[model samples]
Target: MVAGTVSGTAEWSRPRATHAEVTVGFGTDDTTVQVRSVTTTVANRTELTLANALVDTRLQFLTAGEADDLSVAADGRTRTYDRTVTVTVTLYAGDQDTETVAADVPVEIVVTNEPGNSEESGGSNAGAT
Candidate 1:
């Protein structure tokens, strides 16, 4: 695929009352993807963000302690000492786009810090021992 900042909105073809799966990858740290919450069953449109909806995996080789020293950008605010997380979204399921009718759905990704480590240094000071 392409490697760059993933922004903007993409459309997916998902059916009604169905769930879609998404996976995300982070940098060379213990960062991970998480879905805080989701609003999937009420409106025809589903809204997802860092606060809700996330990748379905975690980071290895990165210690749980070190992960506590992560940060994510959200709503023009810098979230420090947060969970390094990523997000993936399934716009639709099948084919929401047809020559006859077309529908474009949108999803949001919000990065934030994870809560757990209450006394660890916010990392960011990697040098040497």
Candidate 2:
């Protein structure tokens, strides 16, 4: 198992062997993120699974604001949202044979809204013209 950290706006890439590459993307709500493996080792026969605090049993990306909203709801405040995601890769080596690797990745979702600069911070114009 491997452990690491990633940001919401970045992609994490892990290369295995000489021709296998694992890429993970934390896409925005409007973006379609797909987990795929390009490898010559197993002829592209690979399965990817992504599990996190907000997702499970599948590989997918959270929406742009989804993580931030979840963090706020969980703690009544949001600034830097943090979550742990686990990625599992299963490679089919041959008939009835396979190899699996798991990684525990920490993700940091940055809330772009700056305090005192947004209405949510009770700015002077919060309720005024």
Model 2 per-residue lDDT tens digits across residues 74-127: 222345645555443444434432455556565665543322344666643211
lDDT, candidate 2, equals 0.38
Those runs of model 1 whose alpha carbons end farther than 4 Å from true positions after fitting are: 1-17, 28-43, 54-61, 64-86, 92-129
The best candidate in terms of lDDT:
2
Q: After superposition, how far is residue 64 of candidate 2 from its true place, in Å?
A: 5.6
TM-score of each: 0.26, 0.36
Could you give me the TM-score of model 1 versus the true structure?
Answer: 0.26
> How big is the positional error of residue 14 in model 2, measured in Å on the Cα after superposition?
18
Q: Which residue ranges in model 2 land beyond 4 Å of their true spot?
A: 1-40, 43-60, 64-78, 115-129
